[model samples]
Target: MGKLKSYQKQFQTLLDKGIDNAEIRHKRMVTRPFDFAEKLEKEAKSYSFKSVRQAHNQYAKSLYSSLRTLNERANGYAADLIARIDKEAAAAGAKSGNSKQPAKKTSTRRSTTAKKTASSQSSRGTASTSTASA
Candidate 1:
């Protein structure tokens, strides 16, 4: 009801017009949860024999439960969601776009190991070539 201070005039106008569009419906939908939350907070401060944090936590839990009853919870959202999924899939060794994801200043030790492995392979190849010719 505290949050409703802004909308008292608007609600009155709607009552007079008798039109219920998404805007009016949406306002009611949003305000209802807030009103429920405020009531819960007041009850926590008044009736409960508990610590402030404990009462506050209970209030939050109740508020979330009320909100869940109000709205449709869903799986995913927009283009950013798709892009994030693609990044995670690529990280799990699935192929993604060629555009590189910048990694931080990596371990030089790994690069050194890679260089050593390449040099060892080249030396082995050279030895094999000479042995074959001989």
Candidate 2:
């Protein structure tokens, strides 16, 4: 169980790092300054024609796809880990022996206290009668 917990924590850390990396890469790719020096060169015409906005969009799409893949992988890993943990727990429970049998049901015998109380109340006649509903 301890090992399983450790594995789960490690998986969570990996997922967190993946998310952070994706965010950092996305920010870096999208926020870069446009290169004005490339405009003067004839050979840079094809690349220069592509606007920063278009480049940013492309990078964003790529990042989104990669992040989605990462998330899917993480989900699969987490699921497998949970399943393994459950299997281990079930095996442990089985090994400890099935001593958890249902408790014996004792018969609920009615007591004669109600009858005794009623007889005593009757003997107290007038007091009991005075309190009775009309």
Candidate 3:
């Protein structure tokens, strides 16, 4: 269980780092180039590219950031679920261990006494019924 927790933490950390790296790469490779191109187009007074690349880049970055946050939240949820499962498994294991002992057998003498008592009670009931009928 401890190992599982450790692994979950490590995996979450890795995912966080991966998300950060991806954001950095996206800023460097996509947003920065689009910004530069938008500037160049504005300076050159070229209306040929009417695609609104800068606005698209901005929207894309906003969406990407949201996705990154959502991914991190998902990782957190997964970690919580793993922890919960581990706790339940440990509890079940403990219950099973305690219950795994062999059940105690009833003493033969006690069983014999119980049988005798039952027979006597039945005989008395029959005798009472006979007396009532009489």
The lDDT for every candidate, in the order shown, is: 0.71, 0.74, 0.81
Candidate with maximal lDDT:
3
lDDT of 1: 0.71
Per-model TM values vs. the true structure: 0.22, 0.38, 0.36
Q: Which parts of model 3 have CA positions greater than 4 angstroms off?
A: 1-51, 98-134
Best by TM-score, which number?
A: 2
Residue 70 displacement in candidate 1 (angstroms): 27
Per-residue error for 118 in candidate 2, Å, reads 35
Assess the local accuracy of residue 101 in candidate 2 as a C-alpha lDDT between 0 and 100.
75
**Comparing 1 and 3 on TM-score, the stronger one:** 3
lDDT, candidate 2, 1-134, per-residue tens: 99999999999999999999999998787664434444446455656555856888999999999999999999999999999999998888889885467655542222354445556777787446533421
Tell me the spans in candidate 1 whose CA falls farther than 4 Å from its real position: 1-20, 47-134
TM-score result, candidate 3: 0.36
Q: How well does model 3 score by local distance difference test? A: 0.81
Over all chains combined, what TM-score does candidate 1 have?
Answer: 0.22
Runs in model 2 deviating more than 4 A are: 1-50, 98-134
Candidate 1 lDDT by residue in tens digits, 1-134: 86697598788987777756766888988998999999989877776465777868999999999787655333334556888988897776645455566675466766776666666766777545543333
**CA RMSD (A), model 2:** 21.1
- TM-score attained by model 2: 0.38
